[model samples]
Target: MTKEQIIFLHIPKTAGTTLREIVYAQYAVDRITPIYRDERFMDMETFSQLPPEKKDAADIFIGHFAYGFHQHLSGNRPYKYATMLRHPIARGLSLYNHLKNLQFAGSEISFSELLKNKGSQFRNNQSRYIAGWGTQKMLETAIQNIEKDFLFVGITERFNESLLLASHDLGWQLKPYKRRNVTSTMWATNYADQLRNDKESMQELQKLNTIDMQLYEYANKRFSQQIASHFPNAVEKLLHFENRLHQAA
Candidate 1:
């Protein structure tokens, strides 16, 4: 197993759940950190204060934590951060739909109310996680952090390619995965189509995610560059991986 501690900053609703399961197969149970699910987040400050030996036991830390969360860990081993970004508007809509589902039945969130909630996680959330916090210069900081500190930044839209690319980058033995945590069910609302039909609602969602949009665009560009520079036969390998997944299915 690699000595480097891999920190997965799982931005909500970005196919992180599916990727998380794939990664779990790559490590021993004890080597992986406890992953808090749904809404109860791990107390970062409490976890950060754990003794070095205690913290050093795990080789991989996985969570819905922010980008710089690795800073909280003991400085005993090398750290490599990774995350997945999605098209900001789509991601936001997904989050909105998810929260609406969580509420008491019939208490649906109107598009206007979702847009106006200043504390909504869907609002510039990808940038907040990437920059590790909100700030005036968040985009610049997030870009620099990605280039300088992160081992990989995967795109949720291009999940298969991103997984293969990340496996290659991070020394992982590849696995075929059936996608999990999908909203491919009768209950999940088709909010993207709804947003497209309503101009004002769409514009409001767009406005809320401007920084996240920029960050996602940059991640996509970097993803292309990284693949070209690192995986010359990526297309063939990706095709082969897809064939395996198809066969497995």
Candidate 2:
């Protein structure tokens, strides 16, 4: 069978690192097209900028990207697009905590200060700011560019199921999913701190994450509707998919 040409766009704070690792492992076995992270391929000016040479390295593109990517997606490329989403609130919390940890590593800005200023500095300067600002801006960009591509959208909340479907589509052996990069003692408390120290910032987080919230809600609703429309017994299939995975582990 001809190998399916695929691209995995790794959006920030989504289970992207884990997915990228999986794809990298598959690519090494000659199971998929050659792919790597190149910055030149993605031409967006905001958020984090990737190196220009990163684009020339892959058959399947996957990384943290913004709008206008389709213009650069290789043509005649039979492509399947896959991405994972996280709850906007959860993502926002993750981002904030990540930045605060970095501050301990030499960043001078206090987490509370960053929260108070509304991410103006982070958004304007950093390569990948987690202030959770402008999520709609990112989503709208992806939506516009990926309209014609074969896209598979999944939520991190349902990661293993999504991986099973993706592996099946790509004709790969499915394995039980494992959590990657989890530290034994690391915990999440940054957002909780905000609730105590900066009520205003918490509110902004809600507002900034509005787009992500909508995107997730819409994607779930859309996926459910699509499954129900196309497969007469989709709920059963989904439940079975979950049950089998659970039982196997």
lDDT of each: 0.79, 0.53
* RMSD (Cα, Å) of model 2: 6.4
* Model 1 RMSD vs true structure: 2.2
TM-score of each: 0.91, 0.65
| Candidate 2: tens digits of C-alpha lDDT, residues 29-58 | 333332234554333433124343443334
What is candidate 2's CA lDDT for residue 145? Answer: 39
Position 122, candidate 2: lDDT: 25
Summed backbone clashes in each candidate are 0, 12
